[model samples]
Target: MTARADHLVGVLGGMGPAATADFYARLIQHTPASRDQEHLRVVIWADPTVPDRVSAVLEGTDGPYPAMLAGARRLCELGVTVAAMPCNTAHVFLPRLVADTGLPFVDMIEETVGALTRAGTAPRAVGLLGTRGIVHSRLYQDRLRAAGIRPVEPGPEVQAEVDAAIRAVKRGELATAGDHAVAAVRRLAGGTVDAVVLACTELPVALRDSDRAGLPLLVDPTEQLAVAVVTTCLGAEAHRAG
Candidate 1:
């Protein structure tokens, strides 16, 4: 069997530094193992200066992709088998990122889809809550449909709350301080459907243990994605034996 240290989980995070840290914390706590060696190898490049993914995409990156690429390359250099970004918006550039970095990346979209499917939660209409770029670009919508699930875009007014909460986090607000975000999500989830996917990493921690909207709520994709990463990075025999 390969030594656990021989593998590393590359995190292209720091879209919100705190959320990135939160994802790591959750992974460490949730990893199923008796020995520390059973824990997955991990590396992270928390580049807070990666620019606003929403603006960069909707408006324009208007600059070099060097910084983003450099971050991923650094992880690959560290010898990580799989790298994943916690930021949903940054996913906009992932195809090129994967091409340029030559690093196997766990897709947040695909991971989310698979998680929903495993729970047998497919085909249930889900409320969309994410950056304007994600919503306007219909990023989640396209992928959700591919998974045979229906997605509902939050009305413009509710989206305002989502935007405010995201912006507040960017401004370095306490992850759980955004009361309005919870209120916004609760409003959107009411009488909606089966569940709400936090979609944004910033949101999972930001939303925390707040009251649910009488509808089931899905927490951080980052946390779940981390679980997926650890599972995938574990050698085949280890996984089978696990």
Candidate 2:
């Protein structure tokens, strides 16, 4: 039987519980549906027990890939139309998940950079904020560069603050996390970047409403990812219905 719209979206999440919730919330907000039935059907496999993604990248261990693969496999078994993972750092293992599941995985980084280009919000340079793994991996750097947008990185001290902010959010210290995040953004913006990307999913939760009175434009990759998820799922659903 074909996968129905009522069971279209498979979420490979739980790199952190809060980020997973935020992604789903954003998906709801982005979807065009106004009622329960109109909304895209979503099934989330939130395995908070998965290994830490940063530790895996930084310390050279298996990390969360195996657990993530298991979740993706289950979703595919259930015949989800497409899958997405909200955690930016978790994307370090996305290729493996896709290979194991043999399913189409939405590329959050690609979607994010594409949003910047298509939105015409950041015509020049863009600033990045995320964990040390995200920066060290250079995940979005080459992609942003190839798109003709310069990627500006925060200095060591400011990056330390970014790292601290990510950790604070993981600890559920949203207030402290917001302060560090705002401070880092202000520093990165001072260097003349046209926009700042909250490349890390946790940042959206941390700085959801923190003041950004005079900083450059802020781009949330999570939001971009959500848009991609909604569009892909809903468009496919419409096609199947027709």
Candidate 3:
């Protein structure tokens, strides 16, 4: 089923709880709110059991497709008008899930790419810092290249570090201010490209503390997607009324 024009946007999240929360916060932050109603009404299903997206991609282990479907279906049953996932790598199975499911999952990478182009990013080299699956997968590459941006990747060692940091967040080791993933950020800093993308939700683990200055970084695809959700699903009437 589709949204009824008044129901809240549903999120199929919590692949890593931290990233899910981040996306939720962004939804609130991006809204032009004066009161509680001004804020978008969001119903979220942050299920961690959806399996490790990075692990399935890199180690060829199990993924959370079935679990993810269950979570999204739950949101639909709850009368969600729209649904999306904050996790990037989990998008790998989006086609399959979306094909059979009634709920439509938003495109995280496409949203980020749209935000970049709207920000007038140079159509040259753009760096990516995501899980091993996203790094190696053509998910970002296919969309980014179509947008005329050559997506750059971290070296093997840096890729390993990023993967480690993502795992660390899942284990609840990193601070909100960002501590454990500094080295990885430094390795893929401004010098690497005009801008960098924290393609994985686990990244911002070392927010300000990481070597994340100088170049612009697309820290949250969820944020960009949320903004679109607010504008589209909710519309200006909601914002104005809020």
Q: Candidate 1 residues 32-52, lDDT tens each?
A: 678977777788898988766
Per candidate, the number of residue pairs that clash is: 0, 0, 6
Superposed Cα deviation of residue 150, candidate 3 (Å):
1.3
Top TM-score: which candidate number?
A: 2
Task: Name the candidate, 1 or 2, with the larger TM-score value.
Answer: 2
Shift of residue 227 alpha carbon in model 3, Å: 1.4
Give the whole-model CA lDDT for all candidates, comma-separated.
Answer: 0.75, 0.83, 0.72
What shift in Å separates residue 60 of candidate 1 from its native position after superposition? 4.3
- Model 3 lDDT per residue over 28-135, tens place: 776776677655567888888777777687776546777988887788788776678888888887777777677866788888887777775554667788877887
Of candidate 1, the 10-residue stretch with the lowest lDDT total is 233-242
lDDT of each residue in 1-242, candidate 2, tens digit only: 33335548888888788899999998888876657877778889999999888878877667677788888888898778878899888777877777777877889998999988898454699998888777767888988999999999879988988888888988999999999999999888888788899989988898987987887788888888888877776555432210
Alpha carbon lDDT at 57, candidate 3: 74
The numbered model that scores best in lDDT is 2
Worst 10 residues of 2 by lDDT: 233-242
Q: Which candidate do you rate higher for TM-score, 2 or 3? A: 2
